[model samples]
Target: MMEDTIAAYSGGTLPGAIGICRISGPQAFALADDLFFPTKGGKMSQGPFYTMRYGQVRAGDGRALDLCLACCYPGPSSYTGEDLLEIFCHGSQAVVACILERAMELGARPAQAGEFTKRAFLAGKLDLTGVEAVADLIESQSAAAAKNAASLLQGGISRPIRQMREKIFQQLTHFYAVCDYPDEDLDPFVNEEARKVLEECTAELDKLYQGFQRGRVLKEGLPVTILGRPNVGKSSLLNSLAGYERAIVTDEAGTTRDVVTESVRCGDTVLRLSDTAGLRETSSQAEKMGIDKARESARESRLVLCVFDGSSPLTEEDRQVMETAQGLERAAILNKWDKGALDFPEMEQAFPKVFRLSAKTGEGVSELCQWLAGMTQGEGETLVTSARQAALLGKAAESCRMAAQSAAMGFTADAFLADGEEAVRLLDEVLGDAVSEDIVHGIFSRFCVGK
Candidate 1:
């Protein structure tokens, strides 16, 4: 339990309708009673738990600061499993500052970033995964992302991990039992059953690992970089997708001399589109630098949109663009389709996924949008969105595979038991059972103050 009481402004900043100030610790109710005078003429310290009271917050000089509502939650039933007080006051910078300063003067220190949630974790109210889900839920950008985070907060990921850990623990215990009682004949099917359990656990971990790719895309928008030679309508396509003038479009070659990035929602998916400088040999120092950046962006992006001019014959610059996109997750765009079609047999053969569209007229753009949206559609599958969880799951899966392989190879029970124990340890870390202090601190640091 925390010895010090902490308070912070949990609501939005000034110039809003209301401000919420929260105090959590053993001294929460006492501080509330000292600072707030209830309209019903009863002390807040003596108020019923989980009940709200109309009150006027006052300063140390007995001057009324503002009319507000105060709610008290007693220890072990509150958000942090400690006594908590919430004040809903008028949204004004001066009012909020005064109340917060008054709280500090009343022995309630300011809450650190994610301190409330950290307290919840320490008090056994929530696990590591649940804490992560709370953060994810706050930062979710799309509907799908919010839905998945909500599912995770409900123990969608933790329940399966706990089950797998129990299975591994059972195997370890059985193996130890067989070794301890050599004279007693154990079931002949024990080894086979253990192997099956390990294999199934490994398969489940692998499935979760595979979901990370789609989950990551849903959580953080899919990175898409547009690459092409000069005057290939890359910027125009970017503008069309963004539904505004995000990039300067012109008839002149090399109009875009730098990377222009924008994010737009396409159905449930968010596409982080980067319109890069035209890829070509340039003498201008700035253009050359931009081309370098374009290549770097292409290398780092998940999807490359290589645009080609359909109104003209394919030049060496176009062929060079195709070469850059080779061996990458990419799609070819035949821009200027309204003008005329070009005979590019080689370009057609190289890119399996090609779309013919005029960025100016917005023709056939819907098909491309549909494809981008389809990439992240999961049909309500529970996914491991956190990198930490995915990495731990990978480690656990590898351990399971090693144990299963050892059992198949007829190795000593000690060797496979060590692998099983390691798997259990990794899974425990995933569920916050055996996590390090540094990892917990790092995870909570991502949260805003008063969360």
Candidate 2:
């Protein structure tokens, strides 16, 4: 059978000024020529590669379907390393459907989710890391996440892995050569040099592994749970941070009965803010369950925003909330500062980070947002955003450490050599040098159609 030509709508679905339908495969250009007739009266196949032509897409009966623009990208230079064509048409579902149907009739099949990117991977245009980065870039919600994904797509993580693999391979090659020569004037593999190289590689791998903690937060917002007694402006605070009324705020006590979550961008950081029911003892069964859930959320959160009603005198309930937040990574927010302050020396002593703010007036919230952003900021560090990459890096680091330990203990060359080889193998998997088909499919499966 002839190679299947794939087609899909690649642009946003909403009614916009324009929409894009992309086609790729060996027959992509031929299919475009069959459907798109240039207004200047020429076939699209005769158009220069990478050039867009004003055209009217037609049906099989030569009926004008839509006035559109068409662009062609020849094979080996296209995104999928195949002849690719893109039709820029009116952003209407009817127009998109008609174009897709015409392309199908001309021998184009619908592209599967991530099939375009998967083909790019198979064509040697992108590694597995790069392919994952493409997915991340599409799904990124914050500037930090997009920046990190773009860096990974540009080989920020793969370059270091490739370098480490090369170093291990060099050491292995020298060891093998020395063993084969016996006395043929090849310099012996120096145990000290091998140990140094392995130690360096192990340290680098450990750094990348450590980066996952911050990387995960950058990619998928930092989990922050708001804790405070009823009527202390917890919901108002959540709305203030989110810049919208995500939670209903009223003067009524215990108004929030469940955890309300919203993700908001603060500088480069994305905060997954959970506004839980005010922590308080209640006779109502539902309120009691919500209170229990509040505590559970606090425990699972990476950071806690402990809100205090600065207008009211410290109560036993306030003390209990503060006590619950003790020993966790927390910051105190003295809310309702507009109402006037009350002395709370205990809060000052318990929490190192405290912000006095009025959620109603939007006062002093910028400082808290800045602090949250600073928590995950780093300078030019390679982040391991994928769990698979983190696991492989952990294994590679362990193997390097074992190799270094073997060399330091004066074990035979074979002992350290085996560990070094294992390290190289793990690094290979990290860079898609040697990975299973299932893993590759799983990674690409997360992508959307037309990527």
Candidate 3:
């Protein structure tokens, strides 16, 4: 590690006794050579890349600091497709600062957020999907999200895009060969062939377009907001579903004065459950704000979980909340099932799909999860798996539509060709043909410096 090496973490264990520094890029090895001194055989520069060696980090005067295990990763196969150096030194604020300051003095600019992985993308080792997966993997809140990210990183998204691109390329080549050179006109782009090709492309594009919603849900997790009057067992239901004390259950109303957000795996999907404050008019500022946040959360949520006490009658506020949640995918959660039937037969009949459960007794949570899974079935099967990708897919689909329309209407072939070219351009945007530096920087800027 040269002077540019940055100590990523100052605390990996207690007593501040271990620090990890990752130095990446062309100068990584050179930077490591500047700080690391071998005791006997040689320095860090003498070792073959990818090998770990025992070494000591030293100051300019050569005063002893901490012994460390340093590893070098040469370019093309390394994490960032550049020379990389990993330094494991004693986790001490002073020691880490010493290493980092030495690195800066030697010439290593601190890696920006996501810079290492961004470099990996720029180096052609990871595509756009893989880059997004790296972000998702680092930020995963549930097992489902983590698994999805891992799959994407392993080229789950790239495979289909590549396949689609290949098929389109073949068709384009066949069309051009026939049109430009009549000698090969045996396989002409007649109406039937054109229609067939167009249909196939349309179907595939539609599938990919429809997949965006599901992909977003899976990646971000369904935001399920629980809305109801206070003391309706919303907290208890949250704790029950999560199998832990995720929310504080209280018999008193207005107990949850603010929204509490938590995530849990509901089968293969990640469910980001929000236990909101009871929805009711209140003069108190905090309570009012809480209710407002609850409404906002409910409005934005993928699923509205409306909770009601089984023993109580429907209140005006409950009806209003239900009306607002109309048209949204909702599940009326009937809590306190052990208490007896709720007074409103109409409410029960109105939401025939209501899920009855006892939050205190841990009953019906599985059934609820099942219903949730069923409702979300087939949603993410074809989702684009990344917000960035979804946008591009959508834009590409629009371009394809324009091209297909132009081709169908006998409009200028230039317009048709332009649309096709636009479609290809958008596809290339996602498949790694060309992207802006500002976008790249903006994306990697989210990463921790040492990444």
Leading candidate by lDDT = 1
Quote the positional error of residue 224 for candidate 2 in Å.
0.9
- Best-to-worst order by TM-score is 1, 2, 3
* lDDT of model 2 at position 417: 77
TM-scores for the candidates: 0.95, 0.95, 0.84
Query: Model 2, range 1-451, lDDT digits (tens) per residue?
Result: 1288999999996488899999999899889889998898877887776988898999989999999899999888889988899999999989999999999999999999999998888888998889888988998988778988999999999988898899988877766765676564333347778888999999999999999988889888899999999989999999999999999998999999999999988888888999988888789999999999899999999999999998888788988999999999999999888989777787879998989999999988899889988988888675889999999999999999999898677676677778989999999898787999999888888988888
Q: What would the per-residue lDDT of candidate 1 be over residues 1-451, giving only the tens digit for each residue? A: 8999999998876779999999999899889888999998988888776887898999999999999899998878888989899999999989999999999999999999999999999998889999999998998889999999999999999999999999989988987886788675445477778788999999999999889888888888999999999999999999999999999999999899888999988898999999999989989999999999999999999999999998898889988999999989999999999998776677668997889899989998888998988988897878889999999999999999999877766676787898999999999999898999999999999988988
Worst 10 residues of 2 by lDDT: 180-189
In candidate 3, where is summed lDDT lowest over 10 consecutive residues?
A: 1-10
lDDT score for candidate 1 against the true structure: 0.91
Candidate 3 Cα errors over 4 Å, as ranges: 1-18, 38-40, 169-195, 242-250, 280-290, 341-348, 369-383, 408-412
Q: Please list the residue runs of candidate 1 whose C-alpha ends up more than 4 Å from where it truly belongs after superposition.
A: 181-187, 340-348
| Cα error, candidate 2, residue 142 (Å) | 2.2
Clash count of each predicted structure: 0, 0, 13
Query: Model 3, range 236-342, lDDT digits (tens) per residue?
Result: 88888788998888778899988888876777667889998987877889999988898889889988889888777878877877886787777788888888866
Better candidate number, 1 or 2, judged by lDDT: 1
Give the range where candidate 1 is weakest over 10 consecutive residues by summed lDDT: 182-191
Poorly placed runs, candidate 2 (over 4 Å): 177-189
Clashing pairs in 1: none
Report lDDT (Cα) of residue 189, candidate 2: 45
